[model samples]
Target chain A: MIRALISRIKQGYRTYPFPKKEPVLPERFNGRPVLNHDKCDNCRACEKACPTGAITSQDNKVCIDMGKCLFCGDCTSACPKGVIEFSKDYRLAANIRKDLLVSDKEIKLAQAIDKQSRRIFGRSLKLRQVSAGGCNACEADTNVLTTLTFDLGRFGIQFVASPRHADGILVTGPVTENMRLALKKTYDAIPSPKFVIAVGACAISGGPYIGHTETSNGANGIVPVDLYIPGCPPHPYTILDGLVTFLGRR
Target chain B: MSRQLISIYNNKSTDIGAVPNLPIDDFRETVINSVNTGRRIAAFFGLPHDNDSLKLIIVLADDHQSILHLASTCVKEKYPSLTPDCPQAHWFEREIAEQFGIRPEGHPWLKPIRFHHSYTNNDVWNRSANETILPCVTDFFRVEGSEIHEVAVGPVHAGIIEPGHFRFQCNGENVLHLEISLGYQHRGIERQMTTAPQNRLIHYMETAAGDTTIGHTMAHCYIFEGLASCSAAARAQVLRGIALELERLANHTGDLGALAGDVGYLPTSSFCGRIRGDFLNMTAILCGNRFGRNFMRPGGTAYDIEKSHIDDLRKRLNAALKDVTNAANCLWSTPSVLGRFEDTGILNKQICSQLGIVGPPARACGFDRDCRYNFPSGIFQFKQMPVATWDSGDVFARAYVRWLEIQHSVAFILDLLDSIPAGNIQNKISAMSPCKIAVSLVEGWRGEICHVAVTDNSGKLARYKIVDPSFHNWMGLAVALRNQQISDFPLCNKSFNLSYCGHDL
Candidate 1:
């Protein structure tokens, strides 16, 4: 018993130092969504794949409503161009709701500028996450971003749990009937000027559960989403890029 | 003679014909004949092939490995029930009765299992026909006694544990009977999975049960692989095996800590909890998720394991495992912890076999059943892994078995990591064909998790059935709880750690 006690004391605090020193994240943490219009065929597969209808095509252009997106990564896998990817950047706090909506034109323009900047130099960004009917996969990846390894916060990105405090709501899962009220409630609760980031295919086009009478596919059915992250559950790095794009840090 | 008769009946099937064209009276006779023949009972799922009436499909698995699909059309007024001979079909029949408003003609117990008082009756059933039913009763199976006193605990507990309710009927120190009520954390996962599209449904599959994410995903993926006849990469299979073993290690560590905590051995409990947390952190480092969610896809894994991640995992595993071993050794040396657990909650070998309990709970009681070792999947078939078993059939035996398995899991993880091959992580398949039904069985932390998936011609999910380990082992808990003292309940309960949400679904 004495030896055990001694051993525990010697172990010396393994807890992550959150809110002080930034926690390290994993290599491919699923944090937020970003779109690469250059590679995109604009098939709107991401929009169709979103569980919540977060992505919508208006006049041959894609628009994302971030408010109702869930980060399940269905859209990432559905994208043939590998255009839609998850970025590890997660600083998605916004003061205005309208700022969350990202159109195809805006994304295309951002990608053009980002390519030129990357050619000259190199830069990355931060991301914010929100969970919608997720089994905690998206949440887990978001949390891993702060571990001792990745230290995503070092890149000026942080995951704020509340929509009010968050820059963008990283959404996951096909919004269930039960979670619909909570999703709407969360959107309503978020202060105006918030950006919605739809992470994972479930949030993009209801990746797997689309066209079922039981649930809604993408965020557009409920709220306007800004970015779409596509993947069954988008990798952390893909999420990071999405956040960086949203923040205009890359 | 009786066994032979049952086997014979289980093997032989008398197919009646197309369900829609069958006469109602002839269908009832077919049902009786099938039940009397002793065919392996399967679930009754509603099929809406016709708009005017719903067809009730009964899947019967014969000993010959052939599945017989028996269907009967039900018009609300004149539906036939078959629960009379097949007592095991009670749950399914009641489910169909409540969900589709199709009255099962002579069911002894026809009560609502999933809906609330507000959403009761035929109209509600017709509106939400495909929604998976959930258990609604706040309190099920209440024990009655005059001045015997009863204690109702949980739905929410003081500790950071999943929610479940425990109702104890006791006379001072001795417990007359203990009733468990669950479903507080019902997220309606199965209902969500049914409507989900083919390409992205794996997310729901991974999260169907948190602790058993790998086990569930593997089972789901296996079903899809078999249905599509798509072979996953060998490297992916080995990696999946590694992830599964890691999951087993984490859950076993947590269970051991919880079991130790139940016995008032705080040192062992704290040590085990810390080790479990470390394992979870290791998982986070490796897969970017503590529960190993999103690590698995239909054909293979989502990402490849990098060398640095592997190195990190090995280092952390070595340190954490050392602590765990030392803590377990100390506990074993101490007599108090052992004395309280050794003979408590004894479930004899015979009782275990009769109830069809699987995994550690069964193995601890000398059943020698394990899906990884016996049923063999992925890397388990190629590798040499030990099956931990104990004949004592007591709580101590159960705890010891878990500890031993944890040791095995750590070793397995190490072996797997050392031998992991470099290759592509995923494969592509694009066949949308009918007659696509596949079943996968994985040994979860608790026991065997069986997932069966049926796909339509359009490659959409026709029906998905997941039988969690808890479903088979819950009855075993009730059997063990018999005649034990009230004080021993916590230890007994902890030994099982059954997921109510998994079972309730």
Candidate 2:
């Protein structure tokens, strides 16, 4: 008991103060990508280099879909004039689907829920996470929010085991065929006036496994997603940011 | 008589024509004989052949000799099952039968491993084309008697973990048998591997098992490099090695913490959970993502350590290592933690060997099987890390082995960071040669991650097989539950911590 107490003291408080304060992210961390169309020589190198076909030339202009992007930086490496670069701004969540498509424009971030919805979920948001076909990275990072460092409980967002106890459903993965029914069943189990948040690239646009026959691509068609958190597997802070913003906590 | 299996080295590409395609009888006999002599089957799967035939290829690892033996045999529809003679081939044979329509005759418990449509015209289970196939909807082995009740849990578990079903036949508190039916997490990764765009292959491999990003990606990178006949530079090899160890450190620490949490021990659980994030953050510092996704590429790593950050990296690593030491020591010193862990779930060495389990679980059974020591490649070729083992083959042994590995991994990382070679991190990858086969084995934090890529006449991927450590170890988890308390499932499960999607893939 003494040893445990001493060790706890040595550990100290680990929860980071986010929203109230800026989170410390690594210099190398690739978050929201910026595209400089003016610098593009119309070479279309990045479009070819993109692994998930996230970058495309529409009317000879480059557009990147965060939902499809893995933030792999292959475009940045393939570009000649440095037309593409990922900024360390990790706020990449959005409420609307079209808002995720960025082409030399600042993305419209996730908006707060409506007045009545926020009134209900703003103070205490209980979410049930369903890893339909998640590779476990998204699941792990999402679960990290419950840890001492993230302390998602402080933000009033807890991942409940039963959908009956949740105000929303947090879905991850590409929604494989076998899991499609289960995901729909889970969403149906959550009482009405509940919302759905799709976490990670897989949950939004199938990520890398997009065109495969086994997966339904993402959760969009299966259940109506209210929020989309983007990343191959979004950082824990990114997930928390989405939750807080959607609940109108900030 | 000619040799039935062709011996090959790790990360070395062999000509497709060079691998012996023996008769089915000889192939089965050779595989059974080799496995009986202690050679582990690393990968066994089938590929579509000309006309109506299917070709079965098997890669056997001779750990002691540090060599891989490969052979192939063409089967029209069914082949004599090796699982009857060699128990290790149970899962592999079932997987082959599911992928292609080839039946392993006389095999026990034959069922759909992934519940997917067969690549060929035949269906082993004879379901119609439009039939709705669901995962975990199968006949389970039941003990019918008074007080022989059954408990079924999950395709969607109660936790934030991946989906899989567990069926336990319990007589009161004691479990008679635990049948784990998985396929819910399958996304048809192996099918996608054969047809996905070349640029997207690495991304698929990175997520093959999300937690095992570095391990699977490194294995694929090695396979790609081997096929292209290009190797990563000395510095890149060292960097890859460091990233792999960092992955090991992060995961092993997290497992120990989770094990503590399972037993209701709070101190080590909370501390190690945060410490696991610390290790992940260090990886983020090295590259970008906490999971090390974008860090790996085909020829070499995507990010390189800058000279300016070396000192800071060392400082953080040392601090995290120190924190982990204290956390693990607390776990060990606590009598309650030890009491719950000591013999909760015991898997004997013979059972582990028969099931062909690898990684820490195998090591806990004193099997002495580690890819780093047995099949050295990349940075491991220059410096080897000792294989950590324990004789108890229980939950405590699994946890203690991880603790031992965490220490060794930290020491290995520190040594590499101190003497990081000065050279280019990448080399220009040449076009892959046609009609070639290459095998890459990486010691992922979970265990041995095997990736085998076979290229066609056009240098396109014909068949790419990924054998995650979980593939071999899931059965180990099932067998361990025999005669154990049903309530202790979570603790034992965490001790193994097998991957669901990796196996489903």
Candidate 3:
């Protein structure tokens, strides 16, 4: 026991001081993309290059849906005019669906929880996570928050076993057709006044699997979403930041 | 048994016309005889040939000879099943029935693999003609007796894991039988890939099993490159090998930690948990994404390793691996952890080989079935790593094999990082030729990932079949749980770390 303790003590502090101090995101980390309309040639390469229909253009206008973005940086390479470049800014979550679309000057931010929600479940929050049709990347990243490094427990956020104990439903995957009923049942099982947070591009807008008949085009088609965090599988820091932001801690 | 052997080399694509189409019985005998002679089914699926019939294609891998045999036969709505003779084809036969709506008559436990509707109008099970199908609604194997108990756990699990259902028959805490029912996470990946536009194909492959982004992507790229007759750069192959090893390192490290967590060993578990991230972050430094997404482009890699990235990766890998060694060694030394892990969830060599299991779990059972060693491709052809194994065939063996892999993978990556050849990162690939079938097997973190793609007359996909290692190993997990204490299920499960989406796909 002493050896275990001694070994642990020698290892020193492992948790990142995020929100208190800036999160240490690595170099070449794929994050939120920024598009320059002026440089875009309207070639539609990004639309053609994107596996998911996240990039759409009309009348020489270009828009990228964060909810559907995989953050693969395929768009930047496909565009000949250098219209798109992914930035390290990982704050891509939003409360509303329309807020996910980014063009030139529109940068949608996630709004804080309402006063009634804060009053009812302000001190603590519990989540019941379900992966309807995810690739496991989103699930793995979400689970990473519980580790010693991320330590989501310090923020009083816990993933409970059953929906009855959950304050909200944290959903992953593109919500496959087969899982639609189960997603609805899981949502209905949760107590009323509960919110749903869609994590990853799959849960938000089906990610790379948007057009396949198997998916219901993400979590929105089945249930109304309260928060949208985007990435193919959002970085653990990004997920943590999104949770904290939605909780009104930042 | 008297029929002439028809075969093809691994990683080689051949014209579909070159493969002889034997009679149905001949095909069945060929498959059964091959298995009896010690060959494993690499992939077995149906390809839509015409409006009236479908072609049943069988790929058998002879690991000893480093050769793969391919043969096919046309089958109508009903055909004789080979599952009774070759148990390895059990899931594959069920899958053919589910996908092509063909019945493999005479199989003992034949049921819907995914519970999805047939691709064609033909309904194999004759489910009310046009009635809709639901996933996980199936009649499972049951044992009825005094003190008999059944526990059905489902599509929605308590842990933050992929969705799958498992039914267990138990008297007291000992599990008599375990049946895994999946397809909750099925995304119609195969159907989508049949007509997939060239650019979008890699994306589907990358997402086929998200955790296996590198493995699946490599297999898809190999299939396309083989069909298109394009070769990746020498440097690109090395980098791919590096990325593949890195992925194996991250996942194996994580699985070891998870195994420790299941046994409530917090010291090693917590340390490995953090070290796993360090390995993942190293991949992120090489490419733009942590999971190596968009980095494994077809014909080559999407990103190139720079001097800075290589130096940085070396430093992080050395540091992280040192900590990982310390954390993992604690598990072997701790008497309590050893007691819990050893002698639990045992699947001997015979059962493992009979099930056609692959990856570290198979290695734990004293079988040398690693695709990287038996059937070398890409960088594996140029370099080799020793096969890691253990004879115990228990949870401890599984965990030990993973640790062995982690060390080898880290050293392989570090060595490659030092001597990463400088060259072009990508090569242009053309559209595939028509009427040709291609097979690519990748040693994914989970196990052998088999992807078979056949092109139509117009150079479009005629049929695509993916066999994830999890598809074979899930049964191994079930077989291992036989007569095991029900509480040890999690520990056994973590040792395998099978992918639900991969199997469902």
Tell me, by DockQ, which candidate is best: 2
Lowest summed lDDT across 10 adjacent residues in model 1 chain B is found at: B3-12
Question: Under CAPRI classification, how is model 3 graded?
Answer: medium
TM-score preference between candidates 2 and 3, better one: 2
| Candidate 1 displacement at residue A113 in angstroms | 38
TM-score of each: 0.70, 0.99, 0.98
Tens-place lDDT digits, model 1, residues B227-287: 6667678889998888888888877887787788888887777666667757876766756
Candidate 2 lDDT, A1-250, residue by residue in tens: 9999999888888888888998999889899998888998989889899988898888898999999999999899999999998998899999988899989676699999999887788889998889988999999999888889988889888988898998888999999998999999999999988899999999999998898889998999999999999998899989989999888887
What is candidate 3's lDDT per residue for B370-471, written digit by digit as tens? 989988898888789889999899999999999999999988888887777777989998989998988888898888999998988998898888999999
lDDT of 1 at B324: 86
lDDT sort, best first: 2, 3, 1
DockQ of 2: 0.85
Off by over 4 Å in 1: A9-12, A34-43, A56-72, A77-85, A90-250, B1-112, B116-135, B138-142, B161-165, B183-194, B456-459, B485-490
How accurate locally, in lDDT, is each candidate? 0.62, 0.91, 0.87
The CA lDDT at B354 in model 3 is 86
Reference contact recovery of candidate 3: 0.74
Tens digits of per-residue lDDT for model 2, B1-505: 2378898999999998898999999999999999999999999989787888988999999999999999999998899999989999999999999888899998998998788888777889998778889877889999999889999998887779999989999999999999999998889888988878878888888898999999999999999999999998888899999899999999999999999999999899989989999999988987888999888787888888897667777898899988999999998999999999998799988989989999999999998899999999999999989999999999999999999999999899889888998978888899898999999999999999999989999998899999999999999999999999999999999999999999998
